[model samples]
Target: GAGVSQTPSNKVTEKGKYVELRCDPISGHTALYWYRQSLGQGPEFLIYFQGTGAADDSGLPNDRFFAVRPEGSVSTLKIQRTERGDSAVYLCASSSFGTGRVRNEQFFGPGTRLTVL
Candidate 1:
């Protein structure tokens, strides 16, 4: 089975630009999550989707960040008006279900490194 994957393992951008990061989850996984990790910090949850609906997006910093999961599969994280502070590693993970009751393990992608100048 194919595991989750993310593109452009690395990215460098100027401040105030826009960027889009893509994530492909496991074929049979129904729960997908996006998180950001800053230098020397833990990964912070950004958003999560179950099927085609976003189950939680409260972690998104602001209007500058957005994401979408269509057809209950692949997802994309879009950032607008990027700032130097936005530089970080964006990680994607997936599991069989959203609820943790089943002891599901989250498979993590390599992650996309975004650097905003």
Candidate 2:
């Protein structure tokens, strides 16, 4: 039973570069979510996927942010033209289902810390 995992626990980049963060969810989980947490703030939802389709992507801040979950397993968050304001910790979580009622607890992966300069 592999737990969720994220790559490049830390990242630092120039203000206009592109970056991609990866997440691997636990086996058998059907729902995956991406969120961003600024300093001293709670995680804000960015996108979610159920199976191979995005269920909710309303939280994505702008065109520079995008994510995909293909094969219903691993997912990647891509950011283009990164800005200084985009610096934050990107977190990924997964559960059996997206609904809170069906999946009470979300297993969180150690987040990727992104720093834009």
Candidate 3:
């Protein structure tokens, strides 16, 4: 894909259900990030992966939310025991993120809208 691509553009489920959101970053991008955006608000950082390891995950709300980038190119955000409060748009982004204080421009995906009822 020319840009970041996320699967299941929309997802709806009941509370307590588990959901997995997938993201494929642009080729050669070494950094991946996950975020959640609620109605009328900006995206909330969820996690950041440098290469195949999670460099930062403090943004996750709790243990119920997790993400992995096993291969360094694709990532999956798993939400367990979902709650109505979890309803939001999940966004994924990627960048070269080379060694430096300078942050590279991130390319974002369309996002997966998760609606919990």
Candidate 1 structure quality by residue, lDDT tens digits, 3-100? 88998799999999999999999998999999999999999999989899999999999999999998999999999999999999999999985566
Candidates' TM-scores? 0.94, 0.94, 0.95
Error of 1 at 25 (Å): 0.4
Q: lDDT per prediction?
A: 0.93, 0.93, 0.93
User: Candidate 2, clashing residue pairs?
Assistant: none
Give the C-alpha lDDT of model 1: 0.93
Which tens-of-lDDT digit does each residue in 1-117 have in candidate 2?
A: 479999989999999999999999999898899999999999999998989899999999999999998899999999999999999999999988545645458899999999999
Which ranges in model 1 have alpha carbons more than 4 Å from their true place?
Answer: 98-100
- Estimate candidate 3's RMSD in Å: 1.3
Where does candidate 2 have its weakest 10-residue lDDT segment? 96-105
TM-score of 2: 0.94
Top candidate on TM-score is 3
Clashes of 1: 0
